[model samples]
Every structure is written in structure tokens, then in C-alpha cells.
Target chain A: MSSTEKHIVLAENLTVGYTPKVVSEKIDFQLNQGDLCAIVGVNGVGKSTLLRTLAGLQPKLSGSIQINDSNLESYASSKLAKELSVVLTEQPASKNLTVQELIALGRQPYTNWIGTLNEEDKKQVQESLTSFLLEDLQYSRCHELSDGQLQRVLIARAMAQNTPLILLDEPTTHLDLYHKVQILKLLQELAHRKQKTIMFTTHEIDLAIQLCDKILILDGAENPFGAPCELIEQKHFERLFPAEMVLFDAKTGSFKVNK
Target chain B: MGNLKPYRFSFILIFLVLGLAWLLNISLGSVAIPFKATFSILFGGQVDIESWNYIIWNYRIPKAFTAVLVGGGLSLSGLLMQTLFRNPLAGPFVLGISSGASLGAALLLMGASLITGFASFSFLNDFSLALAASIGSFLVLLVVMIVANRVKDTMALLIIGLMFGSITAAIVSVLAYFSSAENLQRFIFWSFGSVGNLSTQQVILLSIIVCVGVLLSIISIKRLNAFLLGENYAQSLGVSLKKSRLIIIIATGLLAGGITAFAGPIAFIGLAVPHLTRQIFDTMEHRILIPSVFLYGAILMLLCDTIAQLPNSANVLPINAITSLVGAPVVIWLLVRKRKMLF
Candidate 1:
């Protein structure tokens, strides 16, 4: 551990769920810059709730979340937009928008009232498109892209937002195994290279285990946060799902269907 | 995505169409002024016939102006509605602004006789009609704006607006039931819609109201663009959802209500113009669609108004009738041609 590194996101005893209903509580976690954390849990276990709370989209039932030393709830939306970006699971309303235009919207927080992108904004958008391997698809309509390509464009949009932190909810839900791994690998590289704190919820335990720098596990047992190897040692995945449905392989750090 | 070729082509084509439609509309009416005479009079040259000058300057000019302004108003409202609801089928009238206007008109024209002789303003007076219509539509707009802030869901707001429409329609029905035959006929005539009825004063007032709505739309253009991704995404971009919702509701209400007050309920133009604009442009960016829809909407209204005043016949069709007849078929054709929902 680097003792001098600063924590970008800090959450303590967060209780998140729908209105008047509590799903989970006493969740404590902290992520330093350049740390790629994955929130892993079974379906309906409140992974999305936790992410939404951290993103400041949903109000937390109880507990505090701080981003870059400021309270998440206290920052004005536009000010927070500059510090944190989010990629949702659902698709946008219209697919008629071009990839470049869609990506250009990431500069909304900094753009003039009319949303005109200046030269610096354009340069950032271009760099994101090129770095994300979306240069060729920049001119294509969003509706025309493959699912994988769309996800990459969305990620590029967040990168263009120039936020210090990014949170993606179910970023790999519908992709095939190869595409899922490819996306996870790309996210891993983005976090390490850019030194941006990135966190996403996923069910791809094996890929996440291999790629993520830190694993935050929410299960029927105690919520655990640590390095992936440490999490594997603690057998967090064993408690992740019903044993009757899937079994965790401690040696492989993967889940397999129980015989 | 940055391709300018298609945008440049469409812009030039729509502008040319507007110019041609303007010239043709001014020239064709009860009497053929001849293209040369029309051009001369338009450019400050005195024409041979004096009545031609009166007709062109006094009547045709106001009529054309109303068509353009009312058309632009309706289309801008429709564009805002579709953006707010995220559905192509949404329109200004769908929110019941027209019904509200009708209720106001019905109260003045029909309810007057139902209540008492003293209560009944002259049904034939245009001033009373405009006043009542504007009041009624403005009242509905205020209610709709409140409901918009309360409800986060656009679909629910649409249904609530529809409920408001039915309630107003019910009151109008009661008024119509009690009205005398002469008053009923007057109300029916007013409902048929006439673009030529606006006096210069009413047209000027209408222009001011429409300008207010257009200005609001301009300020909300960026927020509307973020809306293409839905509310959650828009909020993420730092848009004040409450503020945006209020601004949009007010703008839509002003445009729809103001036009209905001056021109009666002009149908189908509000709903159809935006769809056609989308089909022609094949893009959903509000920055492009707002201006494009406004220009195309103006051209469309001019063409429809000209058709209503057929060259030789004295029979002037109701502006609403022409719009619906032409607008409905074009939308159907575009739908069938695309074979998919654009939204």
C-alpha cells in the first residue's frame, strides 16, 4: 500500500435502498486514486443501490459519502459533475445522435450555456475517442453501433467529462464473454494509466478478479473490501451466491456451477 | 456526425422553399395580381389597380403574417412537447391547450345566452373571442405547469393534461346544450378556424406572445438536448430538472394558447411539422431541429393557407381542415416509408 496516496472516494456506514425501505447497511469503503474497484454481489443484493448512492443520484438512508474531501450531497450538481461522472446501464432516449455528438455532451458541465464546445473541449473529446479505439465510429450514429461499441462510446463520453472519478452500473451486463472481458480489461487500463478512481458493479467475477485492483464484496456475510487476492483468501465469493446455484473455487477465484 | 453536406443542402432547400411559398402565397388570392404586379407592390412600386393594393397590403399581408407566426408557434410548441415526452406522437394540442381555448370561446359565445342577456357578450365580436380564448388557455397552462413540477414522469403529465381537456370539454358541452341556435352556429363557425380573421392589433399581440415562447425555447435549447438521454442523464449534466420542466411547460403553453386565441384551433400542423422535420433531417439534435422546424413549419402553413384560398373559387376552406387533410397523409406516408419508429 502507498501510505502517501490520497483517497478519492470515502464512504462510511452507508445504508442504501429505495424510499422507506432499507436493503443493506453499515457498508464502509474507501478507494484511492488509480484504484479500480468492483462491487460484486448476487442479483437483488443492492449493488445498484450502493452505486447510485455513491454517484449522488439517490439519497442515502444513513451514512456519509465524501468525494475529494467534499460531502457528496453538499456539492452543487454542476460542481460535482466536474469531479464525478456516471455511466448508467440503460440506453439513451434517442439513437439518432451521432457518436461524436453524444460524446461531445460530456463537456456540458464546462461548456457555455449554448453547449458550444471550445478548442480544448474538442481536443479532449478527440483524445477520448482515439484512446478508446472509437475514432472510426465517431461519425456513426449511436443506433448503428454494436453493443460493445456503444459501451465504449459511453465510457469515452465519461472520460471526456474529465472527472477525477467514474462510476459505471452493470457496465458488462449484456455482453458476450469475450466482449465482457475486453471491456473490463479496457477499464482496468484506463484506471491505471489515467490515475482516475474507477468503480463498477459486475457479475463477471473471474474477469473482475483478474483485472480490478480492489474488490468490494457485498454478501450475506460481512461486507469486505480489500485486494482481490485478500478477498479470495477471505472466501468472499463463497458467500456471494447461493451454494446450491454456484460454488466458489478458492484456488481459481472463479464461480462454477455446483454438481 | 460532423457532416455538413446534408445540413447545408437541407438548410438551403428549406430557405428556398420558404421564399417561393412566400411569393406564391402573396400573389395567389381572389384576384390574380400577376406575378409582376405582386413583385412591384411588394418592392414599393405602385400597381395599376388600386383595389389590388388594398387587397395585398391590408388583407393578404396580415393573413400571410398570421399563417407564418401561428405556424411557427405551433411547430415550436410541438417540438418542445416531443422533447419533453421523448415520444414523437406528443404535440402542443395533445396537452389540451386547444380544448382550453375552445372552452373559453364556448363560455363567451354559448354560455352568455345560457346565463342571462346581461352576461352574454355579443357572440360575433372578435375582441371578446380573443380575450376569452386567451384567458381559458392561459388558465389551463398555469394548471399544467403546476402539475409538471409535481410529476416527474412525462407520461403521467400527459394523462393529467388529457384529463384537464376532458373536464373543460364537458363544461363546454353543457354550455352548448343551453345555447340558442344562432349562438350555436356562431360558436361552430368560430371552431371551424379562420386565418383571415385576425385584425392588425390581434396579430401584433399574437406576435409578442409567440416571441416570448420562442425566447424561452432558445434559452432551454441546451437543456432540451440533454433531455434526449432522459431525465436521469440530464440531471447528471447539472440541469435543474424542476427549472427546466417549468420553463418548457410555460413556453409550450404560451405558444399553443396564444395561437389558438388568435387563429382558433389550427390542427395537425403542430403535431405533424416536427415529425416531418425529423424525417427530412434524420437527426434528433435540438439545436438543429428547433430552427429547422420553425422555418419548415412557416413554409408549410403558407402553402396550406394558399390551398385553402383556391385561386378561382370564393370558397375559403377552414385552415384547420387543410392542415389535417394534408398533414395526416404526409405523416402516414413517412411512417410507412421509414417502416420504423423514429423515436
Candidate 2:
């Protein structure tokens, strides 16, 4: 790590899971400012669980998360909100809300009693809309937007929040290939240009490898987290998929299923 | 700039409709007073008889005001519940608050006389009944909030609320079975929901509670909108999930419980008014939706009250029954057409 680098998120000995059992344990991870990272895993390998733990959406088992050198638990929810923004995969059922209104919700942390958007908030919201190319649909209802469009709208909402750290869970799950690339590109741009530490969980390992600055691979059987290159050099990727159908091609840096 | 004029004009038009509805409600009644005479009576002008003044001032004004207050209160609570639960079908009735209130009222009406005979203490009077209903509804709200806090899934919370409502309804049914004949009549009448049953003092009390609740809800607009995304997202926006939930539950209890105490368990306004407001304004900003629903609900309740008072030879129809006649079909149509729109 560079001496000048500021660690925005640090997970020490973290254990994440739902009721009855733990998904993973003893996890230590650190995300520096402006780092674009991806958490990669197969289905049910606890990618989302890890993200939720980092985002403080779930209680950690015998561990601590520190954001910006402060204990995660110590930050009041609103203060934490001012520092971090989260975008989940589930769509909100606020059908009557227009795109602009939905985006305006990002300013909730800063709004007064009446929820009025001030000039600065308005500028940020407008910039988010422009960056997401959603200006055309700003007046459209969320229910009327396409799945890809809705996903962009949600991202715009998070961008409008203007937090230093952003966590997304399967943001491109509903997007087409073109939009998926577009979104990943946008996230990469956000991390570099806006100096945001972007962490997202995705099953698209190939795309993640090409775009992410660092990849945290969670192998269900063995070590849950390792740098993408470390895992690849260790030949851990081969065992992630079944041996018969798919093989990890180190040359191409991708998995190819035998047809 | 000129195109935006229509939006302003439509807003004013809706306001005018609400004003006209209020005026018509104040004027037209069984006594059939002229508009000018009613205005004069309201503004302290000459009236033919003291009885006319007394009827207009004491009876009609309070009754009309009760309708508006109860209407606005129920609809506001409905809007809040729908937004809080993220379910369009979720309202005071669906979440069991109305049932809880009804059970409390039934207990007061049915169990009071027996308790008074045995213990020489009367706890089933109207004021006591209103208090009991408020407590009962608030208790249900507390339970719902606890469940919502524990469960992250919105659909699961909705299911739990429905189950709670059914449980409260079962309790009310059991109370109905053991009640005396006269008490049963009173309980049954209260269950049908009427806006005209409030005495002047009762109207004043209900209005105060409803207005306070509405004001609290108004102040919670930002938090409520944040909640539109779901609890986690709302929390991420710095909203205190527990605090917001408590405020909503308390406000909902006050509005629904107060209305139920006096107007019985008024239905359909809470379920139908928010949807209508959403359709009219084409936006979900609570700043607009809250006030719009209030006006729309008031007009709807007044219109239903008018229909209930139609020239039925023997008696007026129950207000609940009349509202259902109008509201049920609209709800059914919304369900059919926008099957997936609602949560």
C-alpha cells in the first residue's frame, strides 16, 4: 500500500451469514480511496452476504468494520449515509415516483423537514441525471422505465448521494450485455474521476477481470477471498466450476465451457 | 412557461372542488336550509328562527366538519401505511388497525354494561370506547413495527400484518357472540362506519387528534419518501428506521383510531384515495400526494355521505355500505388493470 493512500473501508476478522450458520469467517479486507473492486463468487458462495456485512446491513459475527478510521457502529446512520451510498438489486415499488423524484431521494440526508432540494442538491441531481444519460426520462415514472433504464436510475440516485464509498449488489443482473459494459465502464469512471471507492458483487467474472482494479474472489470450498491474479496463479479458478464441462484458461484469463 | 400553467390551473381546480364539496355538505341536509340562510347563519346574519340557527350551528356544522376531518385522517393514514409497508393494498384495514380499533369499540359497547353491573364501574362509555380503540390500534401498530424491524422483506411484513388483522377480527367476533342484545346492536352499528354519529364535542376532539396526526405526517414527508426505496435504502439515506416506523405507527394509530372511535370502522377511503391522488398528480412527492389525498378523500367521503342520505323511504344506508358501493369497484378495477403496479 502507498503511504499516501487512505483506507476508506477495512474489514477485520469479519464473519457474515444469516440465521443458524456462518457463510464465511475470519475475513480481513481493506478498500482504499478510489479503488474499484469486485467481489466474485459462484451462486450461494456469500458474495452478497459479504457486501451486506460491509455495508452494515447485517450484524457481523465477532468482527468489526471501520470506515474512514472510525468504527462502523459508531457512525450514526445518517452520518454514515453521508459517507457511503448503497444500491441493491431489488427494485423499489414506488411506481408513482418519477425518475427525478427517485433521484431526489438521494439528497434525503441533507434535506430539511419539507424535503426541498437546495441549489447544490439540485446541481448534483442534475449532474447525475446527465452522467447516467437519464435526462430524457427524468419525468418518466419508475414503473414505466425499462429494466436497464431503471438500473441506471438507481445508480444515478447513488451518484447523487455523492458519498465517498459506494456499494452495489449485482447491479448489472438485469442489464443486457451492452448496458452491463456501459455500467461497469461508468463505475470505473466514477472510481477514477470522482475518487469514489466502488465495491460491487458480480457473477460476471470475465467482465470483472477486465474492468476492476482489484478482484476479491470467494471460492466456496477453500479460501473465500483472494486477489484475482493470486487465485489465478494458484489455479484456484479451475476448481470453482465443475471439472467436466468448463476449464479455466489461464492464457485467455476466462472460463470456457466445453461444448 | 405557458404549458406549466395547466398544472397550476388543475391544482386550483381541485381546490375549488374541495371547497364546493365542503360548502354543499354544510348546506344540504334533512332540514333543507337555503344556501344564503346557511351562509348567513355561519357569518352571523339574520335567520328566520332560533331553531334554524341552533340546527345549523350546533348540528350540521359539527357533522360536516366531522366528515371532512375523518375523511382526511383516514386517507392520510392510508397513504402513510401504503408507503411505509411499500404495499398499495396495505392500509389501516389490511394491517389490522381498523380491526383492532373495532374490537376495542366492541369490548367497550358490549362488555361495559356487564362490568358496570358486577363491579359498579362503567368503563364502556363513548369516551372510554374511543380511548380503548386508540390503545388497541396503537398496540397493533407496535406489533407491526416490531415485525417490520425484524424482517427485512417487505412482503413478509405485509403478510404478518394481514395475519394480525385476522386475529383482531377473530377477537371482535368472539366479543360479538357474548354481548347483550342492545350492546350488540350498538357494536354492530359502530362496525358499519358512519361519519354522522359524532356529537359536537366528540367531533371537536376527533378533529384535534386528526389534525395533530396529519401535521406529524406532514413533517415526516422526507423520511416517508426515503422509505419508498425500502428500509435499508432509507437507512442509508440517514433516516432512523426505528424512529420513522414509530412516528408512522403513532400517526396512523391516532388517525385511524380516532376516526374509528366516532365513525365506526370507515373503509375504502384509505385504500382508494392514495391511488386516486397518484393518478391525478402523476407524481409521488408526498408534499403533493398528502394534500391531494386529503382533498380527494374529503370529497369522496362527502359524496358517499350524500348517497347514503338519498331518499330511501325508511332509513339511510350505512356509510360503509355506500362507500363500498363506490370504492370496491374502483379497487377491483385498479387491481385488475394494474395487477403488477402495486406492491
Candidate 3:
């Protein structure tokens, strides 16, 4: 459709995996402006691989990924940096960095050669801090903050980057359930309010169903992505995991273990 | 900006200690020049005796100068390596860089002396030793850069480096076994590590190389700070990993290699000084840590060199022994206290 043509990400027959191993092939997806999408699947279903491929950290096994109508591989690294931002699952080597200091690092790509933050850059960082409700914790060292607070700071950094597309790998990996939902809801709010495309990989299926505008379920050889209700209507969520004890309920948009 | 109160306090304290250490190193050697005479001689003013002027200007000044550069350079490299590999125990030698230098020195000091029967050429004229050390460290740098590309994990890279160090050290031991007793003593004396070894021209060369290293370090601080959060986070923040890693490896090689070539592989100042600076400054920001470590390292090395002189005795102790003795305890204490750190 003409509507999907103005996408932030336009992937055509994209195949993704590490070198010498192809996980998925001939897959296509278009994530349009302001779309908050979640890639949900069981463990080892290549959710991370797909996110990484799209982030341009790893080479796409086969096919093309275009951002802003240009091929992903065609952009220079510095140019690609401004267009795409990523939040990783790996833990930082904490050296007692303050919340403000950590968030300001997001301006690195935009900053000059010496990495000095200009007046406008500082203002964006401040806005990100306030919007994330991290003004109070801005002076606190990362080690002193709770997991929830640190996760918020990471997301704030992503927001500060001001990229069109934000790729996060398991943003809620270490948080409590409440914090997990809190983070997801915040991201959902940002996607609509800022008119940015945000895609993240998560195992939090129910929360993804509730918060994401579109759900991308990474099943073997299938690229199921559509409006959450559409995926539920088509019974794609039910086909997600072939586990004996677990089941997906379309009415609740959640999973239950048959105990 | 965060309040500069801590930075201000540490700056004054480190500067004061550095001044005191400099005075101590100059004034109270085995031949005790009076404080006034040492001061006068240092300031290019009148001293009681001409010999006292020579002692202060020729011997102690160059010695103290060497200490400052060696200390400052090694500490900077240590902090860089520790952050790069994200391992606390990783030091200037963790990558076998210094070991590579020692290997070169060993081949010359022990091996060549055995084969050619020309050991202890002149204790003060260590031209061969310096050249051997430089060549050896450069080879290791090459090998390290090659291996660094192949391994992504820091732990794997460190282990590979340690293996290389072990191999080189074993070769040194083999050289030592076949060498004569006099050659062994000369080699041991070289291993003892002296700050007074460099002549003025050598110190000038050392300063030039170390200046380049320190400048490179300053340039890499922002990237290194990002790296404090690990490689993935750094990459996500748009840091070009391969490029940054290359710069770090080369910068470290220059810093560590230059010092070892001139200063005889001095130990533990690199390992311990960065930790001390971090603990004292209470911040891990590389911008602050670089200057802090440089000043603190100079102070500590000057202090150690003083102790090694033993003040009254003509017999000076080996510097490596003193550094290990003083440094090992602080590291142990830090580990015992923190209990929850790897980087």
C-alpha cells in the first residue's frame, strides 16, 4: 500500500543470521513511521539476530534493508549512525558514571570530533532526562540506581539520539515485572508522541501484545507481523509456541501454563 | 557540570605530594646534599660545593625526570588497558608487552653474552639492552594486533596474551640457565630496574615518545569512557570498535614499550597507580582519571625510588622489588574491600 511505502524500515526478502548460518530467508516487513513493533518469540527463535541485522551491526544473510528509501548497506558508518540507534542487552562495565553523564553519551554521533556536547545537545539531554522522569536521579551514579532507573536512563539515551528508528535488544531483560511493563509503556508513549519507529526484541509476549502497535512473532520460517488484533484474529499467537503446558488466549492477549 | 570540589581537592593533594617527593628524591640520596644545597643546585643557584651541583643536576635530576615520565606513562597505559579489556587485574604486562621487552633484553643480556662471551659490557652503558627491549616489544605489539583482530572476547584475548608472555618468559629462563654467573648478575641488575639509567639525550627521546603516548591517551578518553560500559554499549553508542581498539593497542604499545625500553620493565606502578587514583578521585571518568593517574603515578614512583636509595647506604635496592612490595598490598586490600568488581 502507498501508506506502508513511507516506512522507516523497508526490508525486502531479508535473511538474517551469523556467518555461515542462515536462520530465516526471503522475509519481508515494512515498519512505517511511528510504529511501535515488538519481536516476540520463544527463546532462541532468532529475535535478537533479526534485531541486530536491522540495526546494521551484523550483515544481513540475504536481501536488502532500506531506511529512508536508501539501502542500509549503502550508508557510510557515520551517516548510518545518525539514522539508527540501538540499546543492547549486554551490561555496561560500571565505572560509577552519573545518570546525566551516561545519557549525554548518546550525543556522541552528533557531537564534533572531540565529542563536546554543544548547547542544543545539552538541552536535548536535559529534555530526555526530564521526559524520562530521571531528573532527580541524574546526579546519581549508575551503580546506586535501581535496575528500573538504569533501564530508564538507557531508554533516555536512545531518545536523546533522536534517531528515526530505535532498535532495542531485550530492554527489559533485568527488570522486575512491574518495571518491565513500565518500560514498555514508556517506549509506546515515546513512539506515538515523537513519531518515531521503535522495534525491540522481547520475551514479554503479553506486555508486547498490550503495548506494541504491531507484533512481529519470529516463528520458524514465518514473518508474522500486523496489528496486534489482526495477529490475534488470525490465531498466529496460538501457533507461537508448541509447548505442551503453555497456551495463548486470544481474549486476554496472554499466555497461561496448564498446571 | 558536577561540582569540582573533589577534583579540586585531589589536585592540590597530589601536587603537594608530588612536590614533596621531588624534594625528597633530590635532597636525601646516599650522599646527602643538604636541603638548601639541593634546592640551590636545582634552581641553578649557588651550592656549597661544585660536586654537590653535579650530583643534583647530573644524577638526581635525570633520575627524577625518568621517574616522572616512566611513572606517568605506565599508569596511563594501565588505565587504558584495564578499561579496554575491562579487567581489573589487567595491567601494562597483561598483554605480554613488557614480557616481550624482557624477552628481548634476556636474549641480549643472557643469550648473546653466553654465545659471544661479552656480558656486562658496561653497567651504565646499556645501549644493547635498550635496543633489544625496543625490538622485542615491537614484535609483541605486532603479534598482539594480529591476535586482537581474531578474538572478540576480552578474556580470550587476555589469556592468549598471557600464553605468549609465558612462552617468552620460558625462553628467558632457558637463556639464564646457560649464561655465566657474571652475565646473570648483569641481567639481574637490569631486571632490578633503575630510573637513573637514561642519559639526557635518552630522556629527551623518552619524553618525545611518552608525550605522543600521553597525547593519544587524552584523545581517546571519551571513547575509553564509553568503553567503560563494555564493547556492545560502546558500539551501540556509535563507537567504531575496530578503529578504537586499534588506536588503544597502538597507544598502549607506545607507552608501555617506551618505558620498558628505557626503564627496564618497572612493575606494579601501572597496576596499582590507576586503582589508587580511582579510589581517591571516586570517579571513573577518563578525563579526570588521566591527569590524576599521571600525577599520582609520578608521586608514587618518586617515593619508591627514594626508598630504593635507602637514604644513607650506598647500596640501593632494586625498584621492581619496592614497587611489588608496596603495590601488591593495596591491590589485595582493594579486592578484599570491593568484592564485587571485575573491571
Candidate 4:
């Protein structure tokens, strides 16, 4: 571990869920700048709830979440917007917006009151489009893009937001294997190059192990957090699901169907 | 931002068309005033006919102004509702603002005579009717705004608004059934909707209300654009959801309610003008959309009013029928040809 590295995110015994019920609790994790992390768990294990809690989309039931050494709840919404951006599972309300217009919307925090994009804002949007390989589709309406292209556009929008931390919920859902790897690799590149702390929740355990700088295994308890090799050495993935259904193979960091 | 350049010419053309349409609306009414006379009168030049001046000043000009305010206000509120609710079908009347006004008008024209046994009291003038409708719509808006604060789901708020419309509509029908035939006819005339009867004072008041609403809409342009991505995303963009929602609701209420009170619930213009404007201005930016919708609606209203008066004829059709009859088919044809609504 790099003892001197600055931590961008720190959660101490975090508890998260809806108002009436607790989905998960006693969770602990810390991420340094430029780390690309994944939270993987079985269905209904509060993976999304934790991410939403961290994004300030929902209030945590208990425990503390600190972003850049400040309480997550301390920053005003407008101030928090400058610190983090989120990509969710829901599609945009209007598909009629062109790709360029949609990306420009991410600059809402820094733009004028009427949301007129200044030269700097325009430059960021252009850079995001180019880095996300979306320049060709910039003029096309969002409805015209394929699923992979739309996902890229969404992430690019978050990039244009120019926040220090980015959160995504299932950014690779509804994509084929090649596309999933492409997106994860792109996210990895974005975090390493831009020095942004990026985190996402996914069901792709194998890919997460392969590409993520850090892996958070949400098993409803013990909620192990560390590098992939450490997690594998600790046998956290083996306990992810019931042994009769699927077994985790530590040799290749992939799961196998038990017969 | 550079995308706005291509749409500049379209805006200028629409503005010119709005001017021409305003002129046409003022000129082509039941009386055969020549276009030259109309243009001269409009520019402070005089024609030889004295009564023509009276008709133009006292009757046609106020009606034209009312048409512009009603059409532009309704379309602007419709655009706001569509963006706020993120539903293509949402309009100014979706929150029952028009229906509330209708209930108020119905009570004034019919229920008062039935309840008091006075057979339409002398105190209930056009101004009083407008006041009653305005009060009713304000009450409904207050309730809807309260409900909007409590309900986190926008779809639920939309459904609740629909229920409010249904409840008000049921009450209006009950009022209609027990009233006398003369009272029923009075109520029917009010419901038929006209842009012709507003006085100069009422037009000035309406202009003020619409201006306030337009100002609120202008302030909301940034938040409205964020809302095109849905409420959660909008909130993440630092838009205060509850505050912006309330502001948008109040804006829609003032525009829709004030217009309905004066013009008596004209239909189709509020529901269809935004979609029609989208045919030309393809972007979803409200800065362009708000103005484009206002101009398109003003032009369409002028054209519709001109047709309802039927150009030099004594017969005048109901403006509501004219709007729907002329507009519904155009929307249908556009949707069919385009294979989808741009929303």
C-alpha cells in the first residue's frame, strides 16, 4: 500500500438503504485519487444503495462518508456538483437532444445563469467528445445512437462535468462482452489520465478483477475492500454466491457453474 | 452554443410571419375594411370612414392583442409543462387550470341563477366572470402546487393533476344539468371560447400576467434544460427540484389560468403548438423554444381567429372549434409523415 497517497474517498462503517429498512451496514473503504474501483455483489446486496449514498442521491442511514476530507452532507448541492458527477441506469428523458447539446448540458455548473457555454466550457465538451470517441456522433440525436454509443455519450457527459470524483451505476449493462471491456478500459484510461477517482457498480466480477485498480466485494458482511490480488488471496469472491449454483474459481478469477 | 446560429434565420422568418399574421388578423374580419386602411390605421394614418375607425380601435385591435397574449401565453406554458413533466402530451391545461376556470365560469353563468332564483343577476358582468374564473384556477393551482411539494414522483403529480381535472369537470357538469335553458346557453357560449370580448383593461391586465409568467419562464430556462434529462439527473446538476418545480407550476398556472379566464378555455393551442414548433426548431433548448413557441402560437392564433370570423361574413364560428378542427388534422398529418413526434 502507498501510505503517502492522498485519499479522495473515505467511508467509515457506512450504513445505507431506504428509509424503513437497512440494506447493508458496517461497510468501510477508502480510495486514493485516480483509482478505478468496482463494487460487485449478488442481486439485492445493496450495491446500488451504497453508490447512491456516496453520490448524495440518498441519505445514508448511518455512519460517515467523507469526500476529500469533508462530510458528504457538508457541501451544498451546487458545491457538491463541482466535486462529483453521476451516471445512472435511467435513460435521458428526451432523446431529441443532439449528442453535442447533451454533453454541453454537463457544463451547467460553470456556465452562466442561462447556461450559455463559454469558450472554456466548449473546449471541455469538445475534449470529452473526442476522448470518448463520440465526435462522429456529436451532431446525431441521442435516439439515433446505438446502446454502446449512448453509454459512451453519457460517460462523456460526466467527463465534461469536470468533477474530481465520478460515480456510475452499471455503466456496462446491456452491452456485449467486447463492448463491456471497451467501456471498462476507457474508464480505466480516464481515471489514470485525468487523475479522477472513478467508481461503478457492476455484475461483471471477472472483468472487474481484470481491469479495476481496486475491488470492493459487497457480500452484505465483511464487505472486503482491497486490490484484486489481495481480494483473490483472501477468497472473497468464492463466497459471493451459493456453492450449488455457481462456484468462484480462484485460479482464473472467473466463476464456474457447479454440477 | 454554436448550434444556435443555424436557427437564427428561422427565428427572424417566424417573427416576420407573426407581424404579417397580426396584420391579417386585424384586417380580415366581418367588416370589409381594405388591407390598406387597416395598415394605415395601425400606423397612425386615417381612413375616410369614421365608424371603421371605431370598429378597428374599440373592437378589432383589442381582440388581436387578446389573441396574441392568449396564444403566446398558452404555448409558452405548454412548453414549460412539457419540459417539467417530460411528457410529450403535457400542456398548460394538464394540471386542470383550464378546467378549474371552466368550473368557475359555469358556476357564475348557471349555478348562480339556479341557487339564488334570480335568473342571472345583473352584477355578473364579463369582468366578474373573468374574476370568478381566475379565482377558481388559482385555487386549483394552489392545491396542485401543494401536492407537487409532497409528491416525489413527477408521474404521480401528473396523474393527480388529471384527477383534479376530472373532479372539476364532474362539478361543472352537475352545475350545467340543474340550470335553466337560458343559463345553459350562456354557459355554453362562454365555453365555446372567444378571443373577441376582452375589454382594453382586461387586455392590459392579461398582458401583465403573461409578462410575469414569461419572466418566470425565462428565469427557469437553465433548470428546464437540465430537466430534459429527468429529475434525478437535474437534481445532480444542482437544480433544486422542489423550488424549480414550484416556480414552473406557478408560471403555468398564471399563463393558463389568466388566459382561460379571459378567453374562456380555448383548446388545442396549448396542447399542440409546442409540438408544431418543434417541426422547425429541432433543438430542445428552451431559450430558443420559449420564443419560437410564442411566435408560432401567436401566428397560429391570428390565422385561426381570422378564419373563425370568415372574412367579410356576418357569421362567426366558435374559436375553439376552429382551433381544433384546423389544428388536429395538421398534427395528425405531421405525425404520420414524420413517423414520430420529435419529443
Q: What stretches of model 4 exceed 4 Å from their correct place?
A: B116-123, B138-166
How far is A173's C-alpha from truth in model 3 (Å)?
A: 2.4
lDDT of 1 by residue, B179-233 (tens): 7888888878777777786788888888899899999999998899888877777
Number of the top lDDT candidate = 4
TM-score of chain B of 3: 0.91
Docking quality tier of model 2: medium
True contacts kept of each: 0.55, 0.69, 0.38, 0.62
Give candidates' CA RMSD values in order: 2.6, 2.9, 2.6, 2.1
Query: Using TM-score as the measure, which candidate wins?
Result: 4
Q: 2 or 4: which has the higher lDDT?
A: 4
Instruction: Write down the worst ten-residue block by lDDT for model 2 chain B.
Output: B1-10
User: What is the DockQ of the complex in model 1?
Assistant: 0.59
Model 1: CA > 4 A from native: B1-13, B116-119, B122-128, B131-171
After superposition, which runs of candidate 2 have C-alpha atoms over 4 Å from their true positions?
A: A220-231, B1-11, B114-122, B147-178, B311-314, B339-343
Best by DockQ: 4
* Clash count (model 2, backbone only): 0
Worst 10 residues of 4 chain A by lDDT: A1-10
Instruction: Go through the candidates in order and give each one's C-alpha lDDT.
Output: 0.85, 0.81, 0.83, 0.88
Scored against the true structure, residue A231 in model 1 reaches a CA lDDT of: 87
What is the TM-score, restricted to chain A, for candidate 4? 0.98
lDDT of 3 by residue, B24-59 (tens): 888878897778887777778996689988888888
